[model samples]
Target: MGDTTIAPPPTAQRRAGVWQAVLLLAGSCMPVLGSVLITPILPQLSEHFGDTPGAEVLVPMIVAIPALMIALFAPFAGQIVDRLGRKTLLVVAMFAYAIVGTAPAWLEALPAILLSRVLVGVCEAAIMTVCTTLIVDYFHEERRRNRYLGLQTVVTTLAATAFIAIGGALGVGGWHTPFWVYAVSILIGALMVISLWEPTAAEAGEPEARDRPAKVRIPWARIGVPLLVTLFGGFTFYVIVLEVSYLVVGTGVAADDTATIGGVAAIASLATAIGGLSFAKLSKLGHGVLLPLAFGLQAVGMLVIWIVPGLPGIGVGAVIASFGSGVLLPSLLTWVVAAAHFADRGRVTGWWTSAFFLGQFLTPILVAVLAAGLGALPAAVGVVGIVALLVGAAVGFALRKASAAVAA
Candidate 1:
């Protein structure tokens, strides 16, 4: 180990914080991987339950359902973390996530599986905000925080790749293969419960270090930009998730090749991971230039893939867009946290999370309707492309405003 040195409060010495970063990042990745691991298996889900016509809908419902619940509850997650403390909330969410994720694979009844998914959703809302607050504890200063957040995004992307590969392998084995991805939740959840420490208010950057239940007020004026941006990015993401499986399975790709879907997605997410990690090294334009630039690349990529529909073309487009999203995430998140009032970070972040999931929830349903009516591939890809363009323009506006304000 390198020489360890003591530092004053609010100083984040990079070398010593490595393990802390890993633990927190790993803890944070559990749900993201959990959600997507099942994506490639949706066709299989539809076939299995297609006895009734609407049973096919359950596939998206299972994935998006959790997001729906999170959308509703995320506004309060920060408050709960503030009231209960970070470690306690993290432990509970992790445990609940483990059981809920695992039970779906092991249980006999479909209802049980659905119920388990809902439970996992409940747990995920708590996990997301708490982990975010924990990051504030681990890193100090804007540069350090953005880099760390980039690292965290990369971790999730890498996990997404691994789980996608695993989901594919299992899906190829039969429909049951994807469900086995639940094992990851158990292991990760255990790690969180056993190893992580709950940071107090001082650690999380809230005012009080002691246990006093406090109501966190929303800082709409302060966090308006970041919160809104988060919601927009989420909308773009949901639109893709809405149409991906249908584009493949409905358009002559074999339903059994969950591996193919996973492979393609991983390819894109890998680009995303790289883009985000690369942005971390830069001191300037990581937010001002990089976010909107990435967003623009994403828009172009989406349009290209939509016009020419094939795995090769579509995958390339997604890769471009994915990297853009990757670059934006860390910068935007850091911006939001920095902009919020110290007293109300929790509440502000809670609303931010809610907006993020709300985008995830609403866009997919709208895309689903379009896919059913207008044909899956054309509607999903076209709509996603348009959404990406609109969001890119909006991000450009935000960047200009942020820059002008900073200069003024």
Candidate 2:
């Protein structure tokens, strides 16, 4: 009924190891990495496989299938992290990711490549869940944890943008070349083995605490609202992510030029990353304030792009919209992490990840239906923006009530 966050003092515990944080940051990049890595080359792959049966559907599936897998498998990965421990699962999953992610490099068959992509997704689920769980484990104080959450998002956005650029450049060499980027995880995993310890309550302060699993009752009622909001947040966050290039091309400003479109996308992601960089400072304002601001920026930004005249106008909109997205993730994540019990963090985080990615995977379909009725892609995006503003207002009011009750 009231705020349940445990905001420990800044000196609550010693800082987590630098290498440990590094490994987690690197691993955190894995989920979004696959989503955007192959996007730049989707058209090229589609054309190359034009002769193959169901190439149209299957080729595009290469870009989206991993997200589908993550949405389906993250909860399972969370269960494994809770029972088995985070270190082993994460290390093994990262190694497995490399092999599966690179499978398309030498494989000629579309079905085989698609299968490999699915496997990569499975590994990514574990990788994403473990990395995030460990982060919560490493940082006990709310401020520090929120800072890292912000940094984690910055890494994710910047990494995704870089991967898209790399994938585009490598697409010139061949679509297969981008798959090699998956191999980078193997290197990260090796370092993870050296640096990451299996975090336990004992280490943080409880001397008697063991790494053994405990059957703790989850606070589902507390988590339900945040998770529901996250589902919608995920959809809104990705609308620009998946649609920006399409929107740019649709404007007929870029003239179907992939390079120019990619440039615009990279700028947008950079703006998002810039916004993330500010989160540590802005976090002091609390989610009740931040949530409405984030949604409001996104709403207005989307509307700007919908009616604006040219590439510059769209680029400005993308930046504004992206900045909101950049802030939104950490805000939601910090809220969920604070509300959840430490013992149940893994499962809660897993459910949170699943809800977010599920929304992401469904974005295109939702936008498509909206576009059909709205009569234009930009109009559909505008409608989504309006919905986001309403959602933001509702979340802001609820958060205000929750905060006020805590104050009372």
Best by TM-score: 2
- List model 1 lDDT by residue over 1-408, tens digit each: 987997767644233266667777887787676577886677777888778556766666877778877777767787776566677877777767766777766565566677878877778788777677677765655677777788877887788767766776678776665765556656666766766675545555544434544565666776776777788777765454445555556546787686787566667778878877977675376466666676676677777667766666667777777777677667667767655544455566667767777877887566667667866555566666676667767767877887799999
Tens-digit lDDT track of model 2 for 1-408: 999999976433345866777789999999888888888788889988999999989998998999889989998988887777888999999999999999999999999999999998899889988898888888766777777889998999999878877887888988788889899999999999887878766543344445535877667889888999999999999999888887888878556686788788888998889778888899999889998998898998899988886777688889999999999888888888655655677788888898889899999999999999989988899899999999999999999999899999
lDDT (CA) per prediction: 0.69, 0.86
Candidate 2 backbone collisions, by pair:
none
Per-candidate clashes, comma-separated: 2, 0
Candidate 2, residue 156: CA error in Å? 1.1
lDDT of 1: 0.69
Least well predicted 10-residue stretch by lDDT in candidate 2: 203-212
